[model samples]
Target: MTGTAFDLPLEVLRARQNVKWRKYAPDVLPAWVAEMDFSVAYPIRRAIERTVREQDYGYPQRNGQNAELLLAQAFADRMQDRFGWTADPALVQPLADLVQGTFAALWAFADANDGIILQIPAYPPFHSSIAETGRRLVPHRMHSDGSRHTLDTAALEGLVDARTRVILLCNPQNPTGRMFSRAELLEIGRIAIARDLVIVSDEIHADLVYDGRRHIPIASLSPEIAARTVTITSPTKSFNIPGLRCGVMHFGDAALLARFRARVPGHMLGAPGIIGIDATVAAWAESQPWLDRVLVQLHANRARLDAFLAIELPQVKWHQPEATYLGWLDCSALRLPGTAFDFFHNKARIAFSPGEAFDPACKDFVRINFATSTAILDQILDRMATAVRALG
Candidate 1:
């Protein structure tokens, strides 16, 4: 309780009921899920506390000084200040979460059986979102050159067809952790524009880039891209508040916003709770210092994991992530008896996200979440080493 946000004791984390901690048995170390093991930023906690204390729970209002408008303004201001993307507060709308935003976007834009082009080994929910919305998933696998991953724009070009209506993009991409460069984004934008497709960009990890690399919003590349883009982002990932369920979808202009609203009814996308809205406002407007501290811990953790893999478990392969706490590890070289996730879970007692969940072809991969304390991370790595060595 007294240490840095990321250094919470295992017992302390286990006491919580969040899925990250409770999804598996207590004996299983969870290096899976995207949730971080950091304490809530003080500002966000204070905002939630104030909302509860004041008994402010009510229907969210969109007018002046209400939760909705404040959230919109805060998000717009954060976009401008952080990424130089001038977002319109009027076009910002809230949703229960990014997945909901994605579903709504697909429902509003693409018809059933239409295709959505998505990079493979993507965030698992993206696959589900496409399926749930009755859209075909056109998988575009990223290229990995042993050191890093890059967009396969050339391969991407062939995947699009007349039926493709949307290009779902994830920046600071999940699992692999590659932050698509501006030039890469421009190419994607060009394709979307030429193909007459909408681009739904998931940018929840924009604030978590490391090594001083900045995240570029794909829609920011050009007016044409923006007009065709629907940006979905939230403070949950960077601020470690997923349970709050607050996310925003920004349409480029009134016309684009109107197109969406006309199809997806407002009532279907219920507003976030009063606490969620207030916590989000505090996260965007007043939690940079806390985020900076968390990032420092995450940076150290990433390096530690990289060194541990290289020295202690050299058979494992991965691309050092430019952003986010997730590590996409390729355990194919180890020739484990089963899938990497199963081997780790059964032998190491550490649960990782199975790569097959992201893409069927990545069965040899397992995504590890390294956002815990140094002590816990060391334990996780040590267990992994022991598990791998036991095979010998």
Candidate 2:
């Protein structure tokens, strides 16, 4: 009823058979992944449909400006509107996805043995990329006091030694959903500048911020910070088009941009798919109204979860995320028979992203995806509460 596409009936959503719906059996509710359980924005859908109807699946081509450049322009415009940050379209590099951009940035900037600083409880791909690329992972673990999570700048400063080459930042961080404030980013920026470190900021969740919080690009703070930062972002996550595989990496330094371009082969860093490009353009250029509606639903769902847990499962502690549809529940007090993931899977018949996936030290936690219809979210909470009670 929010005039958002998220009101799609459960049957309609299930029929599509996306990863969010098909990953688990009919009996199990899938709330493990980052994808939203919502309908596509009408503008995005229309763009895709138009492209298909015209059978225009050829390689994307643009005069003067390539597809990526055009996307960058749209991205820059959106950033200016949404976050009050001015970005140059020329600084935007189109990539297949943010993960590829992160890996490429790490590979291009650091050697096999050099260290790359990551905020622990990070997106899992960061861990894999560092290991697979043979780079040392220096974790700056965030401190959580059960109410809120704080960035450990002192710990980060200590971790920055001669071997540290790059710092990866995830704004509106995944799993925990902690959106770093401008002041916090400024402090981190100071550290990076002092150490002359390359900062690859993954702000894919920039648009998903809640509670009147504005997402400030760490690179957008100052000239010195921009000079050392590479921003990896996309319309895919917020617009529900990840499978379309469209993402962009933004830079303010010419030399750093050149290095990334030189190391990553053009073919490997392929152009955005026709569908993705169309969707990206539509999502960025015309889908703000739809996005606003979706956000309203997401915020309401978050509040509902907070209330539900307070009554049904008081032992499960959580800090309401400032952004993102993820609920990082502290299940340590429950003392479940096994890992939170296992107990939820075997007993609760609900699938949640395991805390261990974010950080090894987070075995007692679990990340729940709350971006779903209220009816379904209520069902998930009811089932989880039943499972917890059954444990006793």
Candidate 3:
């Protein structure tokens, strides 16, 4: 037992009725979504409770120099404290969530029909954002050797054209779990600078890095790199408050910031919920201890998953993620009748994110959420192993 607040009973988790639990049949173990099975942090919970008790549901106030929003100030402070990045509140804008910020940045930086470069095996919504916004997608596939995933710069160069305007970067990436190194980021910076491209970096999983790996925000590399980057991040991923729906977009260039502000309407995009605001402030300010404990549990759960696969499901090929609670499992060797996702859902009663959802070519893979209680994780693996054994 990790003996942490993250360890919750199945009954309690099911009762919450969040999408992670409610989306599947009660019998199916949900290991799909990014949601963590953890209790709300004490400070965050108290902050929300105080707001609810006081009936404080009003517009969020501007609380920093240059008339910056309160969320922006909180986010800036967090960047400084957590990542050693100096984020100016003036350049930050609060959005409903990371997706909103992504879309906004894509719209602000790229023109209609402009080409946008993305690393493949990416988060699903990223593909949709480009499609919905009428931008051309130039996919740069990352090569994986069952251990580390790296981008092919030659392929990246081949994909770019005169129309390319933005490169959507997911650091500590989603399905592949590649926490890009500073050297890697520098190489990307060189490409972006040469091509005059703006980088919209999704660092939502920045805080979840494990195994002594550090997360460096691409914008923190240098003044020039910072100027060309827009960072989209939130406390929701780190603090388990996605339902609150608050995130921020940090701009390093004044001109880019001005363009975004001009494109987005002030009142049309509703302010973040008061509970979310309060929770976010408390989360960034006072919940580091809770986060530390949650990381401990997550790290242990990851090891348990690694051991389970090595012992029982050797053919499955777990990549052993360096960061995030997500596990990218390669089930191609099993050669089930159907895709790995459907096979698991039918045989083991487990719901994993279909790898094809991340990239069309990843039909043999499945992404699992390991940020769960050890007991639950063991149950999931046991069920999976039993299912696989029965097939033989």
Candidate 4:
């Protein structure tokens, strides 16, 4: 409690009822979900407690010292200060979470059966979002050079056609953790612009980039790109407060905002809870020191994971991520009897996200969440090593 929040003991973590801890059996070591095992930032905690104490629980207000307006302004200011991107506070709309924002954008921008291009291996929810909305999922596979992953822009262009209406992008991309460079973003923007497709960029992992890398919002590439983009992001991932249920979607211009509003309507989207709004504002405005500490811990964990794979589990290969805490491990080399996820679960009592969930072709891979304490991570690595060695 006194030092870095990432050092929390497993017993303490298991006592909480979050999905990441509760989803597995007692013997299982879970490294599947995106949420971190770290404690909440002090500022975020204080803000939630203060809101509860004040009995400020009411329908959220839109103006005059209210949570919604404050959150919008904070988001804009944070964007400017952190990424050198100027966002319009007036265009920022609150949502229950990023998934909801994605659903809303798909519904607002595309007709039923319209094609949406998504890069894989992608966040699992993105696949479901498109399917649930009746949109055709055009999978654009990322090019992997056995070590690094890059967007296959040529494949992306080929996927687009008369039916395609949207390009759904995840930056500091999920699972893979590749923070797309500005040049890559420019190419994507070029495709979207040429095809007149709307770009819905999920930037929830924007704050978690490792090393000296910076996350560039695709919408920030130019005025033309911004005019056709909808950026959805939140403080939940960075501040470890996803249970708070707060997120924002920013439309590039007034017309794009109007188009979305016309389809979904403001009331249908429903606002985040007052508690969520307050915590988010606190996260953006007063939690930088806490975030800085977390970044340092994550960087160390990433390096430790890289070393473990090299020395102990060299059969498993991966591209060290540029951002996010997730590690996509290629387990094809292990030649397990079944999927790597099941092998780890049954043999090592460790649960990782099955790669097939992201894409059917990724059955030989599994994604590990490395945002836990050094002890937990070491235990996971040890379990993995033992399981792999048993193959002999």
Measured by lDDT, the strongest candidate is 4
lDDT of 4 by residue, 286-331 (tens): 9999899999999988999999999998999998999999999999
* Candidate 4: residue pairs that collide: none
User: Is candidate 3 or 4 superior in lDDT?
Assistant: 4
RMSD of candidate 1 to the truth, in angstroms, is 1.6
At residue 215, candidate 3 shows an lDDT of 91
C-alpha TM-scores of all predictions = 0.97, 0.96, 0.96, 0.97
Candidate 2 on 257-318: residue-level lDDT in tens?
A: 88777887656766677688778989999999999899999999999999999988999999
Better model by lDDT, 1 or 2? 1
**Of 2 and 4, which scores higher on lDDT?**
4
Instruction: Write the residue-wise lDDT of candidate 1 on 1-392 in tens digits.
Output: 23574467889899998999999989999989899988889999898887678786667554556678888899999998899999888998888888999989999989999999998899999999999989999988887886798788888888989899999999979978999998899999999888899999999999998999989998788889999999999999999999999989999888889999999877889888878888898999999999999999899889989999989999999988999999999999998767888999999999999999999888889999999888888889999999889899
**Candidate 3 lDDT (Cα, 0 to 1):** 0.86
Off by over 4 Å in 4: 1-6, 60-63
Q: What is the lDDT of residue 54 in candidate 2?
A: 85
